[model samples]
Target chain A: MGRTWTLIRRRLLQAIPVILIVSIGIFGLLELAGGDAVDAYLAVTGGGDPAFAERLRQQWGLDAGLWVRFLAYVESLVTLDFGWSVVMSKPVSVAILERLPNTALMMGAAIAFSACLGTLLGGIAALRKGTAADAGITVGALVLNAMPSFWIGLIAIVVFAVKLAWFPLGGIASFDRPDLAIGRVLDVAWHLVLPVTVLGLAYMALYVRLMRSAMIETAASDWVRAARARGLPRLRIVRRHMARPALLPVVTMLGLQAGNLLGGSVVVETVFAIPGLGSLAYDAVSQRDLPLIAGILLVGTLMVIVVNLLVDITYARLDPRVTDDRVRAGGA
Target chain B: MLKVRDLAIRFAGRSASEAGTLAVDGIDLDLDRAQVLALIGESGSGKSATMLALAGLLPKSAKTTGSVLLDDRSILHLDEREKSTVRGRRIGMIFQDPGGSLNPVLTVGDQIDEVVRTHRRLDRRAARAETVSLLSRVGIGDPAARARAYPHQLSGGLKQRVAIAAALAAQPTVILADEPTTALDATVQAQILDLLVNLVQVEHVALLLVTHDLAVAAAVADRIAVMYAGKIVERRGPEQLVTDPGHPYSRALGQAALPFVAAGDGRHAALPELPGRMAEAGGTACAFAPRCPLAIDRCRAQVPPVVPFGDGEAACFRAGETAQ
Candidate 1:
C-alpha cells in the first residue's frame, strides 16, 4: 500500500509538467493558426467595422501579444476558471461540465465492455491455441481492427436503430421516460446501447489481440509450466497463474489507446448525437473558439494522464518488481 | 516408488514419422523411496523430456506412450483430472532457472500455500503455516518474513530454496528436480543440492535429479543414468558410472566432467570431445554410433541391444572398448 501510494505521488508530480507543456503547445498552435472568436463572429455577420472587431478582440484579450494572453489564460486555469465560450454564451467549464456525464457514461461503458469481453475471448484463444477457435478469434479481431470506427458505427446504427427499431436513432435519452430515477437511468442506458456497442467494437478487436498474445506468451513462461507441474488444475493455472501477468499488457494497451478512443469519439458521438467532448471539440475547432478548444484539450490531456497513472498503479499492484528500489530509482 | 517401462514420448503437432519428434524413444528407469536417480545428458538429450513425462507436465502437443507406473497404478493412462490430483500431491517438481521457475507476481509463501491447499485438505491459515515450515526446511532463514517476499526480492539461492519449499509443501512421494542448482553460485549450488539430498533421506521421497554435468550427478545421485541422443545409453551406480563408464558416450561425458572432480591441481588437461552430431531418431542404428569413438561398421547398421554391464545396463555393442 505504501508502494502504491508512492507510485501515485510520483505519477501525479510527473503529470503536472506534461499538462503545462500541452497547454502551452495548444495555446501556441491555436495562436499560430491566426483566428479567434471575433473573426468567427464577424464572418457570421458577413462583415464588421474595424473598430468594433478590434474592441471585440480587446474584450477577449485576443488582441494582446501571445505571452500576455497566454499568462492570463494560465492564471485563470490555475484557479479552475476556463475562459468564456463566445459560441455557447457561457463559461467553457460550465458548457463542458454540462455534457460531461453523457460522454463519461458512454466512454466508461465502452472501455468496460471491450476490456471484459476482450479478456474473456483472448483467454479462450490462448487456451485453444493452434486450433480453429484460436485462428477464428485471431483473424476476427484483426478484421474488427482493420475496419474504421465510423463504418462500424454506421452499420450498427442501421442494423440496430433503422432496421430493428430496438434503439433510438441517436441521442443521450428519449423524452418519454418516467420521472423516477431508475426509469431515467434505464432510459439513458437503453439509448446508450448502440453508441457503446459501436464505440466498444472500435477498440475491442485490438484489446482481444493484445490480450491473446500476452496470455500465450505468459502461458509459455517457466512459471506457468511450473504451475502445471505442481498439479494445479488447468483452469486454476490459467486464472491464478497466467491471467494477472497477461492482464498487464491489456491494461497498458488500454492506456496507450486513450488518445485513439478520444479520437474515435469524434465519429461515434457525432453519429449518436451525444454532445460529448468529441463533438464539443469538433464544434469548438470549426467555430474557431480558442478558449473552448483549450478547455477541451486540457480535459483530454488530463484524461490521458489519469489513464496512464492508473496503468502505473496497476503495474505496481500486479508486479511486485516494479516497486523495487532499483526500478523506482529508474535504474532500468 | 516409481517404475518406468519402455517409456517413449513423441512431440505433438509433428507426425509420428517426422524426424526429431520422438524426443524420448523407449527408455526405462526405476527409483525407490529415499533414493536419488540422476538423469544426466547434454542439451537435446531427452533427460528433461523424461522428467516431464514422469510428472505428466508435458504440453498437449507432447504425445507420451508406454507406461509410467507409480507404485502399482499406471500414470500415463490417467485422465486429466486424475493427473492433476496425483501431480503436486504425489510428485513435486523443481525446475531449472530458479529465478524464472516460480511465479513472479506471487509471494513465495503464497506460491507454496497454493500447492499445500491443492494437495492437502488444509484451510488457508494451516496451509500458510505449512508454507513457512517448508521454507525453513529448505534452509531459508527467517522463514516467516521470507514467505511474504516475492521471487524478485530473493537472491538466486533463496529463490531456489523457495522453489524447493514449494515442491515440498504437499509432502510429495517423489520429486523431479531438473538441474535445480544450475543457475546458482558454486557455494549456493552445493547447499541447494544438499538440501535436496536431505529431503529425500528425511522425507523418504524418491528423487530424480536431471542435469548435464556428470560430476554433479556422480556427487549426490545413488545411481546415474547417462542419456545420449534421446535415449539412456548407460545406468550405473554413481561410483562405477564415473570411474568405469559402460557406454562410450558416458565415458566421453565422464572425461568431459571428471577434470573438475578428480584433477587436484589448478591446471587441467584438454578434455576429450565427442566427434559427430547426434543421429536423427527414426533409424535402425545406435543413436550414438556416429559419435562413439569405438564405432565399427556394424555399429552404424544395427540398433545396439541393451546388455547387462556392472549390475546396470548399457545399449552399446562395443560399450567398454577404449579405442576405435
Candidate 2:
C-alpha cells in the first residue's frame, strides 16, 4: 500500500509540468487568435458608448498585463472559481460542470462496449487463426478502422434514427421536459446511439486487432507450451496463462486510447449535436466566447491528467513488476 | 513394468504424391520396475518422437500404431483425459531444456505446487509446504526463500533442480528424463545426473533416460538401447554393449567413443567413422542397411527380428554369426 501511494505521488508530480505547459500554450494560442476580449466586445456592440466599454473592461480586469492575466487565470483555477462568462453572462465553471456528466456518460459507455466486444472477437479470432472466421474479422477490423468517425456517425443516424425511426437523431434528450430519471435516461441513450456507436466501432476495431496479435504471440511462447504440457485443461490454459500476458499490451493501449477519446470526441459530438464539451467548445469558438472556450480547454486538460493518473495506478496494480517507486519516478 | 511393442509413427507429407514418412518404425522396448533404460541415438533418429508417443504427447497429425502397455493396460487407446491422469501421476517427464520447460513468471514453489495440486487434493498452504520440502529434498538450501524466487532468479543448475522437483512431485512410478543435462556445463551436468540417479534410487521409480551421448548413457543407465533410425538395433547391459558390441552400428558407436590419443602413439588406431547417415525411415525393411558396411542383398529386402542374447536382445539377421 505504501509503495502504491509512492508511485501515485510520483506520477502526480510528473504530470504537473505537462499540465502547466499544455494549458499555458493553449491559453496563449486562444488569446492571440481572438485578440483582446474587451476590444472585440466593444466592436461587436457597435462601438456604442466608449464609457460603458471602459467600465466593463475595468470591472473584468481586462486592462491588466498579459502576465498578470495569466497569473489571475491560474489563481482562479487553483481556487476552483473560474470567472463569469463574458458572452453567456453566467459562471464558466457552472456551464462546464453541467456539460461534463454527459461527456463522461458517453465515454464510459463507449469504453465498456469496446472492451467487452473487442476482447471476445479477438479471442475467437486467435483461436481460429487461418480460418475463414479469422480472415473475415481481420478484414472487417481494417475496413472499420479506415472509416471516418464523423461519416460513421452520420451514416448511423441516417440508418437507425431517420430511416428505421429506432432512435433520436440529435440533442441529448427531449428538450420539452427535462428529467434526470429513467424515462429521461432512455431518451438521452436514444440520442447517444449514433455518436457512441461510431466512436466505439472505431475503437473496437483497433483493440480487436491488437488483442488478436498479442494473444497469438503469447500462445506460441514457451511458457504457454509448458502450461499445456502440464496437462492443464484447455480453458484454464487460455484463461490463466495465455490471457494475462496478452492483456498487458492491451492495457497500455487502452490507457492511451482513453485520452484520445476525449480529443477525438469533437467530430462525433458535432455530427450528433450533443451538448457535451466538444459541442460547447465549438459553439464558444464561433461566438468568440473566450471565457467559455478557456474554461472548456482547462476542463479537457484536467480530465486527461486525471485519466492518465488512473491508468498509471491501474497498471501498477495489474503488473506486480511495476513498483510504486518506479511509477512515481517515471510519472515525474 | 512398461512395454512398447511394434511402435510406429508416420506423418503425411504436404502432397499426396510424396509418401508418408515413417519416423519410428516397429520399435520395441521393455522396462521392469525400478530399472533404468537409456535410448541412445543422434538427432533426427526418431528417439524423441518415440518418447513422446510413449508419453501420449505426440502432435495431432502424427499417426501412431502400437501397444504401449503400462502393466498390461494399453495406453495408445486412452482418451486425452485418461492419458493426462496417467502422464503426470504414472509417467513424469523432464524435458531437454530445463530453462525452456519451466515458466519464467511463476515462483519455483508455485510451479511445483501446481503439479501436486493437479494430481492430489491438498489445500494451498499444505501444497506450498510440500513444495518447499521437495525443493529442499532436491538439495536447494533456504528452500522457503528459494521457493519465492522466479525461474530467472535461479541459476541454470537450480532451474534443472526445480524441474526435477516438479517431475517428482506426484511420486510418479516412472520418470522420463530426456537429455536432462545436455544444456548444463560439465560440473553442473555431473551434479544434476547424480541428483537424478539418487532420486530414482530412493524413490524406486523406473527411469527412462534418453541421450545422444554414449558417455551420458553409460553414466547411469543399467541397460542401454542403441537406436538407429527408429528401431532399437542393440539392447544390453552397459558394459556388454561398450566392450562387446554385436550390431555394426553399435560397434561403430562404441569405437567412436574411444578417447582421443596423442599423435605419436602408434598403438592409438585411427577412429572408424560410420559409412552413411540414418536413412529416411519409411517402413523400410531395415533402416540401417543403407548405412551399414555389413549390408548384404537380403539386408535391403528383409526386416530383422530381435534375436535373444544373455539378459538382452539385438535386431540383426547376422546376430548368431556376430555373437561369436
Which candidate achieves the best TM-score against the true structure? 1
lDDT tens digits, residues B206-279, model 1? 99999998878988999888888778888899988877778988888887988655455766867767786877
Q: Could you tell me which residue pairs clash in candidate 2?
A: A10-A328, A14-A332
- Computed on C-alphas against the true complex, the DockQ of each candidate is 0.78, 0.32
RMSD of 1: 2.7
Interface RMSD of each: 0.9, 2.5
Residues A96-151 of candidate 1: C-alpha lDDT, one tens digit per residue? 99877787788878888988888888989988999999999878877887888788
TM-scores for every predicted model: 0.93, 0.83
Candidate 2 lDDT, B170-274, residue by residue in tens: 777888888999999999999998888888778789999999888788888899998888788889888777766678777767667654422235577677667
> Which regions of candidate 1 fall more than 4 Å away from where they truly are?
A45-55, A325-327, A330-332, B12-21, B60-63, B260-266, B281-286, B295-305, B311-313, B316-321
Model 2 misplaced stretches (Cα beyond 4 Å): A24-92, A158-195, A285-302, A316-332, B247-277, B283-311, B315-324
Give chain A TM for each model in order: 0.93, 0.86
Top DockQ: which candidate number?
A: 1
